[model samples]
Target: MHPLRSATAAPSRRALACALSLALFPFVAAATDGMSDARTLDRVVVIGTPTQPLTFVTDTKLPRQPVPASDGADYLKTIPGFTALRNGGTNGDPVLRGMFGSRLNLLSNDGSMPGACPARMDNPLSYVAPETYDTLVVVKGPQTVLWGPGASAGTVRFQRETPRFDAPGLRVQGSLLGGSFVRNDQLLDATAGNATGYARLTANRSESGDYRDGHGDRVPTAWKKWNTDLALGWTPDADTLVEVSAGIGDGQARYAGRGMDGAQFKRESLGLRFEKAFHGALRKVQASLYRNDADHVMDNYTLRDPNPMGPMPMPMASNVDRTTDGGRIAAEWGWGDVVLTTGIDAQRSRHRTRNAMGRDAYKTVAWSPDATLRNTGVFAEGTWTLDAGRRWVAGLRSDRARATDQRATRSAMGMGGMAMPNPTLGLTRSETLPAGFVRFEHDIAGSGFGWYAGVGHTARMPDYWELISPNMGPMGTVNAFAGVRPEKTTQLDIGGQYRGKRMDAWVSAYAGRIDDFILFRYPTGGMMGATSMASNVDARIHGAEAGVDLRLAADWSVGGSLAWAWGANTTAGTPLPQMTPLEGRLTAGWDNGHWSAGALLRVVARQDRVAVGQGNVVGRDLGPSAGFATLALNAGYRLSERLQLAAGMDNLFDRAYAEHLNLAGSADFGYPAMPVRINEPGRNLWLKLNFTL
Candidate 1:
């Protein structure tokens, strides 16, 4: 009973081509009428540039090659040392240097949007649309403490810059995309403003049908998503601003790796912010508050029929939701060459769920609260310029985290056919976590090279998923929260960046040790079907990433990057699970002011070191994954001052490949009984048009 066997027919090639033409007709017409005026236009091209070590910043409005991403995780894969654990075409969990979950602090406009699903059916990045933001910033390693807690791996921020206007004006930007597998996308951003006030709006929609692999086998990856945001700002005077914003989004996705599919991904968000400048030692003040809610529904009968002989055996559904509220206030002071920033922040979140035996019956069941989490932190960061060629940066923070468990009884399925007592019933636990980092940077005399080294330490409390999702606890413990200790990480990071007239390069490396690193143990063929246990162990990790770009001629350039990561469980003497393999990317491009063309050649080394059935919250390693290489081509044309067109072909050779950190296809999808890695999309062609005024 394969799902796709009863799925609807795919779009015909002729129909797809017609749709693409119709979508591009407006841009083509504008190009014909304004080609002579194109000199005033800004070039819109698709290849992303290499990032520097430690910190990288870029404009999110720029289009990316291999087709623009539908979500944040998909877009982050362009950066070195980053990968995603894919379940389908969208909502893949982001991983950095073999770390997942709270280790990588992700923020959208300085707000947190943690998902509610214990199994992570909707990760934080699931609600983020990268292109909707104005800027994207990445800080590697535990280099700073101003943002939030954890972040042992790194920090990612998607921000929208405030708009300023001297007089009444209107600005608009939008794009349309058409691609293989009946993929279609639309985005719009509009703003109207004067010196005293402004109104802004952003909206986007994306949809795609199931795609076949190179072997012509269909993968259950269809999805549809939409988002809309509105904001109002008041500028009382220069250096003063107050703004309020609201947003809503929803989507549905089919997964090939799980028994259930996400039928609803509803989201709502609200935020308020204020900024003001001052004289004397106090340079400025900033504060903000936000609330985000995620409501999700999963069922086996929504998108496909339940396997008659499978574990489920019948239609069923589950609904889960989480609401988070938090705020932060900070003050920035400047004294000569030294700047100091201090802030306090706090957040509270609650989770609830309902389940029913019949399809869509969950709606009739009353919701039951399962967990509540709270955290409050205070921090200060400072930067000092010792001289023209040297600088020092440091920060420290402490957080109090608390979790309350509300389960009345434990599942009896895995307790030897006997009811098990709930050891954590109405129990609450709290921990105090401290974190800090210090770094020094120096510039090479007479050269464009700068080098930096830093040391950081972080103590992290176990998150909801890690504390309550497992079926069993470690040896001698009744449950995870009752025994799991806080995780501590200490690491050293070193990197250098070089900026030259014709070439630019950067490299970053880190080595660290972890205390009480959370680990999951799964028993094979257990009575409850592979029950899991959560425990802690010591571990060591190291990784490095490097990239370079060279200008061969006035209109030609070439670039490439390489990344490698490794980890070991010192207590058990085994290689860590789900580590990304050696990866390299080579890109060549030519730009002639108005037109550009590029090619990307990606090579991944085989990943033979794996600990099967052991990994982070998102997914586990299936087995060893073979190496693969893929070639992609892209071309762009700047037609006029208000229009541009871009086209690309991914996996030009139609090579069948799967990422090492990937979800295993499900038996319900016609996959083998044994877990096997799901293949990536095959040859794909896409065209995009951009318009601005």
Candidate 2:
């Protein structure tokens, strides 16, 4: 039988999934004696390619090429159709098929943790430590209504598996890493549990000094961060579970792409979740409530000496914070050949800011509230098994989205230190958005082929970054808040997957049309330098990601994947700004039960189709970026039943290149102020050790 399976086929029972995943973990077989299977090598090293259609899943603890330095964006970039807008060595912003920001729904443990940076220096992924989570799931396109709304681009979830035990026992896992540029990291996960209850703790710390680029130039990108989380669960019976979790984290990072660096990034979180199963047609019920907060401080003096000849010639700091509270309740029901899930979810976020001219002076000032955002939605998804191998899935959703502008005054966005009275002060805007999708999937009888086609639509409300960040609106409008309209996206997606004894392949492609699509224009520099204006325009987007894995021999395999995206502003007759260039990756692997090795070659094509003076809130395009290729190699060894070691050398050729989606190197770093892209890292080496008990 073939192994082709869709992500929607995930286990319906939590206990069964946990037990199966723990027992069948492939690494266990490869680390123990009496194991001689040639294919066992698949479980020994990095997983760069995927076999599932429309979804990608991987174990977070596994070693990977380029060895991410505790950053979730770095890890996600390894997947097809995904790339990071590089800032320095870490905390890059993730983009999927040219879509970023609120278009991609990012969640950690079923909760939302939005960042507070007005310029998005500290994106959502900046605070997520990949190794602390158990599984990473990416669902491309707005094809599912189970998660919250506004996911026109896709949905990404970092999950911590539910822990279950038949008897009282203690389990522990840990890893340590040391790499070039004084990079170091430590992580630990421990659990003590019995049949009726359990306690789990996860903690991690990561740090790195400034790194040199391919030109041997030192980039201001040093950072240090840490996180700690504790979870307690009660399972009165095999079919019931109640869990409570809390976490806190903080960090700081210097920047090479912007005038100011991230002086502080503090995070706080709390959550409660409940799950239960029944014997009747009502199969399962799950509920959760969570609150997350992000507090950030940006300053020019903390990381580097402020430029005496440029803007902000003195030490200046800005402190911003956002608090997000959300909850969800879902239930699953099964009747013969049909299964359905219904849920209601809501979220509220409040933002505040304070600033001062001297170091640590902002702490003495009272915070000023500027915005409040809220969303509430209800959804229903159902799947019908028409036959043994054919299925139909459909979903419907409606949301009430509200945004309040609490600004007391408006600053002349292009005039240095200029202030003006607010025009939309304390005004509230509300809209009811509807979203839905449908799909038909079939598994070829007695074959390795499976295919699915789906169509989806989502009407997205203007987020804080889009609604409030820009200083101006379209030509005649008063401001961004009153001019920018909601974005409506309709997209069609199709994919197929095939799994055989020696080959695995998958292909996914999508096309979308966006109405009233929000676009930002960077006009000529004014008194305060270049400023952006928010406007609405029609747009077209399309992309495709395909992969194939071939096992030449029992112990040898080769794989390759390619991703390409394209977009155009139909209203302006220009290419879309910030579109990702074509990218491809090739990998070759060889391993025995006791040892494993692999090589990765990444190639990025030049992006020549760019709307030079337009983009999103992150930044605008800087002409065309040239293409480049880099190679990375990794090796691993099973030291014993409870221990293992892995190492990697990235950018082996030390070729200098910058991504298309990049911020210009800041003048504070001794670069010309002509908006040149920041170069990536040079040759790097790292080693890691993992242990389990």
Candidate 3:
């Protein structure tokens, strides 16, 4: 894992002096038992690697569940401060800090992979599987520029590592899952390698049937998908690694809430990366390139029967496709008490669309021209150790991004209407953004105390798709996304950590204000009934997270974590849309020589404050929602040095509840008393077997 440079540029010398002194002030202020020996060591975990950015320290690698993840976002929800927008049973969109779409930089193996559908049915994450990757990283908040720009909420990355062997070796891993509601999944991950190079392949398939609510009522959510990837690597020395990889995936899904369904999601990806460490001068140098393409199709006839209340009330179909490609290169140098890293990155994408009232009309409407988006950036970060117990980190970055609406003409047709072309709305725009940050850390070693404080800022351009496509009407008229401004944010982060053999604790907090925060508001002024359009608005956000681990005894352990966030629009004088609510998790476990068992309890606090209309990325705001809690149990046993077995149950009590940030309730899911909430699964059980050599 690697640390991402902060976005804030620099701190005042006076402020820096104060930050420097206070970093170590706590150690000198107190004298107590068991404190002096514990506070001296720096134990920060490396964050994201260049290829896969957003990562969490806590992981579910050891947890129990069926069905492999299909994308990076799906895997992220296992961590805190994360949620999803459920369309049906699967392929739910990921949300962070109550933000979705372009707000989070979603990257895989060092590249940007945007979905192809104008409606985003094949989001980049739809092609990822966490179990197939060796590592996952997440960074919350607009923390840095190592992974590209416009990551105001943060960055989420999933990556696979190249394998090397001194001798010929082969590895194979597979899993089978089954549970209630006919949920089933299959996964195969295998690799073969020798001293000079290696090859690997991975594939996954999953499907689930409709589920029932607590009241034994049937819900329409259901889904299925498949993905496969292949890779080859070359290694000339122990310190050098190079790899090339390619992958393809496709799937279909049924949605109970929308008029259309995901009929096709085709994905293609290519990537190359190399790393080398210099023995004496600089620490390490790494470079990488990646390209990803998605071709998606949505139709009402493919996934299910047409609904009487749907837009057309008859068999209607429309298709939208878009593709994004991106790459980044970076190097890190370490000398004496200092480490510096520098990098460059770029990305480009385009989109096109066509629609018809019926299947036969598809060929009658020509495809719309593609919309183009491109960006390039440079960044550098350095860390210096002022003394054995004090450290400072500084970083800076700049980017140039441009977007073009390539449609030769736009058409203003009503929903379920014939294609009519309109030529008055088309344009291009460009912007430059810069960001930086500085932080200081101190350890009261031997005192069981340590603390750090940092300030950062980020400037983000509008996402190409968000700025050009989402606002367009089904009839392709009225240009809802014609003019939009970039967004900028400045924030302060501070935290402390405490450790003991029997107890460990940590707390972190952040406060920030955003300028021209890009937002979507329902515009009813247009001739089109109601359409969402992007606009720049001022907003503020702040939050804190805290956790503690305690050893009840030599064989028993207990831990819990809590987080809360508050957001609001100063201009609108209302709460920001889609903000997550207070949540908490608690776990109790017992581990011995060969076996381990554990149980987890999760609780979500109800939310009453809402933007009135601002809701999920694709759904509406239903106001506030009631909170619920669920429990899970897990156990693992080591069969031998080379083998292990594990099993677990989710939603142990079979509680039927929904999250606050949900998609619109569909015929499949009973309409909610409030807004945007879907029924959760009942009790689910799964088991796994592992082998290593």
Q: Which regions in candidate 2 have their CA more than 4 angstroms from the true location?
A: 1-51, 414-416, 524-529
Per-residue lDDT of 1-693 in model 1, one digit per residue for the tens?
Answer: 333323226466633763667466664567345433222433333333435438777677676765688888887887788889888788899998888888889999999999888778899999998878987788888888989889999999999999888899887778778888878888999999999989999999988778878787788988889999999999978889999999999988898877788888899999999999998899999999999999999888878788887777789888999999999999999999999999999999999988888867889999989899999999999989999978999999999999999877665343222446788989999999999999998865468888999999999989988887776667888888788888899999998888898998888899999999988765432221246677899999998998888999999989888989999999989888888999999999888878988899999999988887787666776778899999999887777667667778899999888889887777777877777788889998888877776
Per-residue CA lDDT of candidate 2, range 1-693, in tens?
A: 111111113323422443343334436634543432211222334445553457788778877778664688888887889888888877898899998888899899989887998778889899899989998898889988899988999888999999899989887777777677767788899999999999999999987777778999877777888999999999999999999999999988887888788988899999999999998899999999999999999988877787898777888899999999999999999999999999999999999999988888999999999999999999999999999878998999999999999988767564245678889999999999999999898875568888999999999999998877888888788888898999999999998888898998888899999999899888623211257788999999999999899999977999999999999999989998889999998999887767888899999999999998788888788898899999999887766556667778999998888888998888777878577888888998777767676
Collision count of model 2: 0
Counted clashes in each candidate structure: 0, 0, 26
List ranges where model 1 is wrong by over 4 Å.
1-10, 13-23, 26-53, 412-419, 524-530
Output candidate 1 Cα RMSD. Answer: 2.8
* Candidate 1 lDDT score at position 452: 90
Clashing pairs in 1: none
TM-scores, one per candidate: 0.95, 0.93, 0.86
Task: Name the best candidate (by TM-score).
Answer: 1
lDDT of 1 at 62: 70
Put down candidate 3 lDDT per residue, 375-441, tens digits, no spaces: 9999998889998878887889999988877765443333443444433235667889988878887
